[model samples]
Target: MFSIFNIHRMSVTKQLSFSFLVVIFIGSLLLSLPIAHCHNAPATTYLDHLFTAVSMVCVTGLSVFPVAEVYNGFGQVISMFLMQIGGLGLVTLISISYFVLNRKMSLRDQNLLQSAITYDSANNLKSYLFTIYRVTLIIESICALLLMIDFIPRYGLSHGIFNSLFLAISAFCNAGFDNLGGSSLQHFQTNTLVNLVIAFLIISGGLGFMVWRDLYHAARHFFRSKPRRLRAFAKQLNNHTLLVLETTAVLLILGTALSWLLEASNPKTIGQLSLAKQGLVSFFQTVTMRTAGFSTINYAQAENSTNLVYIIQMMIGGSPGGTAGGMKVTVVAVLFLLLKSEVRGQTQVTYRFRTVPRKIIRQTLVVLIFFFSVLLTAYLLLLEFEPHLSPFALFFEATSALATVGVSMDITTKLSTVGRIIIMVLMFIGRVGPITVIMALLQNRRREVTYAKTDIILG
Candidate 1:
C-alpha cells in the first residue's frame, strides 16, 4: 500500500498530493520559527509547533497550546492563515486563482483539482471554483459584520475587529481555533447573538457551496412569503443537494438533543448551566462536533456517553466539496439507501424518487468502509501505545483526528512524542481523507489492459 521509489514519475493527482503535504510542512516550519523564538510561546518545542501547525493546516483544530494564552498575536495569525488555506482547500484555491489570472490548467491539473475537491469532472470546474470563492468571501464578510456587532462593545474596536474577522473565518472554515482559549466563551455561553451567529457560520460552511447554490435558488421562490404555492423555480433544487442538506439538518438537531441528554445529568458537564445556555451550548456543540472543532465546554471532562455522541457526529462530519471533513453525510445517506434497496431485494437503490447509480452506490460503500478501517486502525494503535486510556477516549481522539473535527478528550497535551506524531499523521490523512489518499496513490498507474473474468461462489 506504500512505496518510496514511486515518488518520481507520479501522476498529476499524486504530485498534487505530494505538493500539498510539502506545502503544509514547509509553511508550518517557516511559521513556527517566530513561535520558537517568541518569549510568550508556551513551553515551546519543535515537535509541538510542528504538530500544531499540521493540525491547523489540516483544519483539524486539535491543539497543544491553549491558543489564546500560548502564543502572541503573530502565532495566532499564522494559524488563522493556515486554517484559511486548509479550509478553502489548496486545490480549489490554486485552480481558481490560476484560471482567474489567465493561466492555463493542463489536463493533468484539471484532473488533480477535480479529484482533490471531489467534484465531478463533467462540471464547469473554473466557474464552480470561482463561485465557491465568491460565495465564501461574501458569506464570511457578512458573518464578520454580524459578529463585530457583538465583539466590538465587549473587546473594543481594534481587538473586536480582529476577533470578529478571525472568528468568522474560523467558523466558516470550520477550523475551530478560537482566540478566546481559556476563557472558552464560558462567560457568554448564553449570548444568543454570538452563539447563533457562530452556529450559522458553521452550518453554512459545512453545508457545501453546491447545496448553498441550490438552496439560494430555492429560497428565491419564497421572497414574496406567499406560503401556499411552491414556485416553478423551486423545482430546480437538485436531488443530491436536497438529500445532503436534509441529512445534515437531521444530524445536527438530533445530535444536539442527544448530546444535551447525555450531558444533562453530569454536573461537571452541562448540568449546572441555565436552560438558555444549555440550549445554546447544545446547538453549538452539535454543529461544531460534526466538523468545526469549537467547544463552549470542556471536552476533556465530557461524560463518556457525551464523548460517544461526539465520536458518532465526527464520523458523519461535513458534506462533500466543503471545508469540513469526515466520511460525509451524503455518503452515509447513500449507504443507508443501498441497505434499504438490498433489504427490499431491489436491483437499484432509490432516494427521493430518484434512482442512484450503481457506481455511486459502490463508491459510497467503499468510502465508508475505508473510513471505518482507518478510524479503527488508528484507535487500536493509540490503545497499544497508551493502555491506561479509556476506550471511549481513544475512540473520540481517533475519530476527531480522522474526521478533522479537532475535538479532543484533552489527551493531546499529555501524549508522548510518538503519540503526537501518530496524531499529526492522522490529522493530515483525515483532512485529505482515506479515499483521496488512496486515489492519489493509484492515479499514476494504468489499469490492466485486459483482465480475465473470474467467478467466485456466493457467500
Candidate 2:
C-alpha cells in the first residue's frame, strides 16, 4: 500500500509538500468538533473549518470567517499549534523528535532537511534546527509578555493573556491571523509599544535563520577581537546574508516612506493621523507586507497609489528559509545583479565584489517566472469570478495569497466559493513554494543526452 505520509519512500520535495497536506487534514478534523466552537458561535460549515485549517497550517492567515466569533479557547489553541508547526516546518520538528529520543539522523535525513529549508550545512543541522526552535520560543514568549502589558489592561486577564500570546506567535510566524474581531491592530495604531514590538518580530522572523546564525558568529568575532571594526565585521559575513540584510533594509525604508507620503493626504487612512503616528503606521504596514499580514489601517480605504506600493512589497516579500514567503529578497537581489551585469556587458554577475554562481542565477530566474505566472493566472481567474469587486481589490487579494502575505483589501468575506478555493490553492502553493511543488510533481528521470546548440533568434 502507498501513502502520502510515507516519508522514507517519497522524494524530499514530495515529503515537504505532502506533510503540510496531512497536517491540514488533521487540523480540519480537529476544528470540525463541536467543542471547537464558541458557546454562542455562528453556524460554521466544514468548508469554513477546512479553509481555516489550510490557512493555519500554511501560516497564510486568510480566513473565510472571523476566528474569534467561531472558535473557543480550545480551537484557538489548536490554531496556534498549527501556526508554530507550519512556521518552523516539519523537518525541524522531526529533528527535534530525534533530539528528544536520542536517535541519530541518517545522511538521507540530513539531505532531505537541507533541501526542505535550503539550509546549507549538513554537519551543524542539529544545532541549526534547535536554534530555530529556541529562537522562535524565546522571541514569541518575550513579545507575548510585552504585548500583555497593553492587552491585559484592555481585554482583562484570561482573554488578554491569550490575545497577546496569539498575536506574538502570529506576528513572529508571519501568520497574521488576529482574533480581535477583524480590525487587526487598527486600534493599536497609535500605541508605540504595540507597533514597534510587532514590527520587530516581523523583521526578526523575516530574516532567514542562516542570516541570524551569521550574525551570531559576527557578534562572537567582534567581542573576541582586540580591535573590532563594524565595517570589518560586516565584510566578514557571506555575500548571501549581507545581501538579504541589505535588501531587507532597502525595502522597509522605501516601502514606509512611499506609503506614508502617498496616504498622507488621503482622509480615509493617514490624513487624520498625526505626522508621527502616520510614520509609525506606515512602518507597521510596510513590515506587515513582508508577509506578516497584521494591519494597522484599513487597506481598502488607502489610495490606489499606496496600494500599488503595497503590491510591490507583497510580491518581493521577506528573506528565504524564514517564516515569511514570496520570491525572497535574495532572489530579487540576484535577479537585479544579473540584470546589471548583463547590461554592463560583463562576463561575471557580481554583488559586493563577490560573484554569484550560474546555478543560483538560473534558480532565481525560475522562481521569479513561476511566482509571477501563478499570481497573474490567479488574478485573471479571480477577476472572472468576482466581477462585483474592484479590480484592484482582487489583484491585492490574489497577490496577498500568492505571496502568503495575509494583507487583504477588506474583501475576504465577499469572495465567492470558487474564489475562496482559488485563494486556498494559491496559499498552499505559495507556502510550499513554486520550485518545491514543481520538483515534487516531476518524475525522477536522468537525461544525459547532449546535442549541438544553435542560435534561434536575435532581438
Candidate 3:
C-alpha cells in the first residue's frame, strides 16, 4: 500500500510538471508561425521563434525582435493571446474553466491550483478562481474603454480599437511588447491621457488578483451589512495581500521619485519636460519599470543612476500570482521583516498583526539566493562570449530578462545568436520560477531519526 501511494504521488507530480512545460513549449510553437513579413523577422530561424514564443507565453516581455517591426497582425494576435493566458496564469485558467464546466477538480488539480495562486487554505480555492476570472475581465474591460478614448483619435477607430485592446491586454498582463514601435512609448511621452491610462492598467494588473479580491470583500462588507460586526468577527487578513499592497505603493512612489531626481538634469532624459510632464512620465516609468514593459522615455538615454534604480525595481517585481515576474514583492517584504526581527532580537517575525512562519522566511532566502545565482551565472557566461559589451549593460540585461521586465539598452539587437539563446533560457526560468524548477528537479527523500546529536561551536 505504501509503495503504491508513493508511486501515485510521483506520477501526479510528473504529470503536472510536464503539463506546465508543454504549455510553454506549445505556446512558442504557435507564436512562431510564418505570417506577413516584417523588418525584425529575419529570413527564418526556429530559435528566434522559440525565444519569441517563450517570451510571449511566459508574459516576460523580453523580446529579441522589435515587436513593432517584426510581427504581423496574425503573429501579434497570437502573441497577445498567449500573454493573456500567461498573465492569467495557465493553472488558474485551467482550474477555473474546469469548475465552470461543472466538472470536479481532482486533488492533483487542486494542489496545482493552490501552488499557482499560493493560497493558504484549500477551502477557498473555488472562491479564489471565481474572483480571479471575474476581476480580470472586469478590470481589463474598463481599462480598454479608457484606453480607447486615447487611442481612437490618434490611430482611427479600427486601428485604435485594436491598439487599445492589445495594449490593455499587454499592460494588464505586464507584458512589455508594444506595437507602438521600437522606441517604446517615446512618441507619447508628452501625451498625458495615454500615459496615465497605461500606467493605471499596469498598476491594476501588477497588484495580484488576490489583493483585488481582498479589497473587494472588504468594500462589500463595508457597504452591505453589519460592517462593524463583520469587521470585529474577521480575523487577520491574508499576509500576502497586505504585503502586495504596501510593497507596490512603496515601489511606485519611491521609484518615481528616484527616477525624476536622477534624470532631472539630463538633456535627453526627463529634464527636457515640464514639471507636470516629468511627474507623469516618472509615474508611468515606475509602473512599467517593475515588469510592465512599457516606457515613456528612452531608457538608453536615462542616467546610469536611473537605470540602476529601474533594475532594482524590476528585480523586485509586483506580487506573486500576478502576470509580473521577479523575485516578487512579498519575498522582499518577508526578507525585510525577518531582518528587522533578527536585529531586534525577537524570536518571531510579525507583519500586519500576524506572525510569519519560519518556512516562509526560509523560502524568501532561498528565492533571493537562487535569483542571484542564476543571474550571476548567466551574466558571466554572456560576458565570455560578448567581450565588447559593458559589464553593467550585460548585468542589467540579464537581471531584466530573468525578472521578465522588458526594458532594454538597445544591446539586444547587437547580441550574438548565443547571447540571445542564453537570454531565452533566462526568460523561461524567470517565468517558470526558480523555486518551481528546483521543486521539479529535486528528489523527495525521507529523513530517518538518528540516535546521536553533535554541536559545533561558531563565532
TM-score versus the correct structure, for each prediction: 0.88, 0.93, 0.88
lDDT (tens digit, per residue) of candidate 1 on 312-373: 88998988778888988988888888889999998889987889977576667778788888
Candidate 2 vs candidate 3: which has greater lDDT? 2
Candidate RMSDs in Å, in order, are 4.0, 2.4, 4.3
lDDT of 3 by residue, 245-361 (tens): 778888888988998899878879778788988888888888897888877787778888889999999899888767788998988898889889999998999987679987567
Pairs of residues clashing in candidate 3: none
Candidate 1 Cα errors over 4 Å, as ranges = 1-9, 35-38, 90-93, 96-103, 106-112, 115-124, 220-228, 231-234, 435-459
Q: Write the per-residue lDDT of candidate 2 for residues 262-325, one digit (tens) a residue.
A: 9999888889989999999999999999988889899988888899999999989888778888
Local distance difference test values of all predictions, in order: 0.77, 0.84, 0.76
Model 3 TM-score is 0.88
- Cα error, candidate 2, residue 287 (Å): 0.5
Off by over 4 Å in 2: 93-109, 435-453, 456-459
Error of 1 at 88 (Å): 0.9
* Ranking 1 against 2 by lDDT, winner: 2
Q: Could you tell me the lDDT of residue 338 within candidate 2?
A: 87
